[model samples]
Target: MIFTLRPYQQEAVDATLSHFRRHRTPAVIVLPTGAGKSLVIAELARVARGRVLVLAHVKELVAQNHAKYCALGLEADIFAAGLKRKESQGKVVFGSVQSVARNLDAFQEEFSLLIVDECHRIGDDEDSQYQQILTHLSKVNPHLRLLGLTATPFRLGKGWIYQFHYHGMVRGNDNALFRDCIYELPLRYMIKHGYLTPPERLDMPVVQYDFSRLQAQSNGLFSEADLNRELKKQQRITPHIISQIMEFAQTRKGVMIFAATVEHAKEIVGLLPADDAALITGDTPGPERDALIDNFKAQRFRYLVNVSVLTTGFDAPHVDLIAILRPTESVSLYQQIVGRGLRLAPGKTDC
Candidate 1:
């Protein structure tokens, strides 16, 4: 089975290959959320020389990327504990950082290229799991090349993920993980090219929650404790917000609601129709979470309320309405949350 890459995807692959030819420093590729990054990863792996290892922070991403690579009639092994597999001898291997970091000794083979899916998650902390894995891999192959792919290159409190962007879109930090951004695909370009759904923001709601009074932590994000206390005081307003969401969702096919916390998610779910809604949090059992997500994607329910779990790896293309009930200072997080609805699905003209 052969798959053809889109023009922009091929361009991304070309840019990455071109970057590696000129420099040995690590670089990143920035593509919008809805873009087919998995395909690009697969293409790069196909053309890459020597053994390749693709790393993702979550098991879902490892599985998804591996599946895409395999769909091209390629053989690749998955090294994620969540998937109950840990084969590392294949020329191309997809792995979750946690699993790979824990069992670094299991991998006897040396890899030439290391690709990180959500590279922005890599911080300057040398003790972090990603850093630990990279350090080990670098020891195995000192000349190893690193490539990162992500939609949002900026971290929450930190600035850019790369020290220098291709066009200097923004200032980069000296402590950034990746050294440069070799290629970037803009969200506007994707929308203009019909590759993604155009997002439409509704007018200000009649009832709104004011997060201005909440204090910010040193990380430039609101503390969950402060948010919870403030939410408790404004508990009366949650119903009004849900009411507006419900009214808006009546015309939408699929709706995803992002809540501040688990308790808030449960409260919102309780207010919604039980049969038509479901709640998912980090604590939800793995099998149960998978089932809930499967059902939601199958349109078993119209509303899915979650807290921090569905921001990155989860995918539901039919989602036409995104109700962000939480507040965040991170531009990356905000874009990720809203990206859930930006996928171009049949009958979904806009989000």
Candidate 2:
């Protein structure tokens, strides 16, 4: 690719490739959101001449990885279910684990190297489609060079980078799960870098986040046993929270709101200044989504309310404000939402 690689990014990619060549074993890359992990993968594919198979967890990610590889000059093909193939006749194929799992017997296994994006999602044992992919790959090619990439290496409920030394899938020095961290590159840093609109820091205000009704619907009590149930009916961002977000947005031009559900997102749109708000959800038709994106780029939408989407791939440089309305125990998810504001905009003024 013609793009320049940051020092840290190059080092991360170098470390991963070194591991792959060293032990002939799988290696993982831990990069925060907005750190251009996709670019790192592209760089790897550029140098490695073998037929590369990239396995992504979701449809959106599959599309993103495919486009990124193509941009990096890798001939790419996608075998994801229900998705049409583009013109990128790929030496590298990006496939959904589910799609390949369903059509395993009919597919070819000539790929010499395999890359797993978000490898932490590879479920336990050989039961899940992910684990099944690993098994199938081993059966098809014994000398496969495997590489995994994700922000968080430790699987949920698994111990930190320390306890996962022998966690079956994690590669590299178990202690080096983290590189020099890049957390300082959040919204505050972006504002300082002039990448976003100057933060119009007005007098601080008090805004309450009311979770009463949601708590009431979710058995009126918090419990690990009720998490999934609570997530289903609970409001991702409450009206009080929305008011605070609006206040914050008033200080910035473009704002990004992360909500829990479609219904919650609709409520957020209603609360934002009408005629200047856009909402994107999984059900948003493709054409409509493209239009919304265009309008957003045109700055017609001051606030973008989103539900469970836009955590990755979707990029808006004007996103000066980010509302983490969704409660998540995942550090990776939190970092992803926050990194939406990390792009360094030069010559920006601090408000």
Candidate 3:
């Protein structure tokens, strides 16, 4: 299969390569949800005719990248569990961050390039898996070049991707993970250009619980336990949200509900007709989760509810309504949750 690139995607590829050639340092590329980043990554691997490791946090993304590489007629091997064993001699390897983080030295040869998908997950903390793995890899090969791709390159408590130093303190806090953003394709621009569906956002007034007393985490977000406790106090909120979803989804084909907890998701499913809805969470068994996702994609159900899952790598293009029952302070999470409905499906004018 021949891979074709749109003008913007080509620009992204060129800009990333050009930045690498000029600076010889790590770089990041920001592209909207529906902008086809896999094609760009395929082209980069095709051009960089050396050992390249594509890293993603989730298994779905690892599999997705390998599929695109195969579609592009590129020889790539998967290094993640449930995919393939670690291929020491393969030039291109698609890897899950969790799977390969411990075995950086397993590869016989030094990788010339490291491409990180969903790279914004790299936290400011030095003890993070990403930082630890990259630090070890750098010790092995000092001249390695890195390319990071993400739609949102900023973290909640941590600053932007290319941020160098904080406002007041300049001596110690020089935390610029990626040197520069080589290219960016904004979601608004993609919507304007008809590449993505514009989100029709609606606000539902829910009873606000006083969470002011809840202890804030170091990341400036409330702890999950506290948030869940606060959310559980408002008994009317879940019913109201369920009613709103039922009302709005009456005219839509598929609705994705992001719940705060597994209990909340089960409650949502309890409200809907048993056969019309399903629930999935991180704790769900692998086979059950896959089946639920497949059934949802097959349109066997009108509503799919998930907690702390399906926000990043799950893709259901026909989802016309995204009901965010989980309130989040992270902008990346908010965008990712809404992005589920941003894919341009037939007759989907707005999400």
Best by lDDT: 1
Once fitted onto the true fold, the runs of candidate 2 whose alpha carbons sit more than 4 angstroms away are 86-90, 160-204, 210-240, 346-351
Candidate 1 residue pairs in backbone clash: none
What are the lDDT scores of the predictions, listed in order? Answer: 0.90, 0.64, 0.80
Candidate 2 colliding pairs, count: 5
Residue 129 error for model 3, in Å? 2.2
| TM-score to true structure, per model | 0.97, 0.75, 0.92
lDDT of 2 by residue, 1-351 (tens): 577887766876677666666666455566655566778777777777677778887776788777887886556788887476532236677888788777777455466778887766665455888777767777878887777776666544444332223224433244432322211123444344443444443332554343344432221223423433454454443566677777666756667888755656777788877888989998998778778977886778788888767776666666777776555556656656766655544433332
How large is the C-alpha RMSD of every model relative to the true structure? 1.3, 5.9, 3.2
How many clashes in each candidate? 0, 5, 0
> Which is the winner by lDDT between candidate 1 and candidate 2?
1
Name the runs in model 3 displaced over 4 angstroms. Answer: 82-84, 164-173, 205-216
Best by TM-score: 1
Scored by lDDT, model 1 comes in at: 0.90
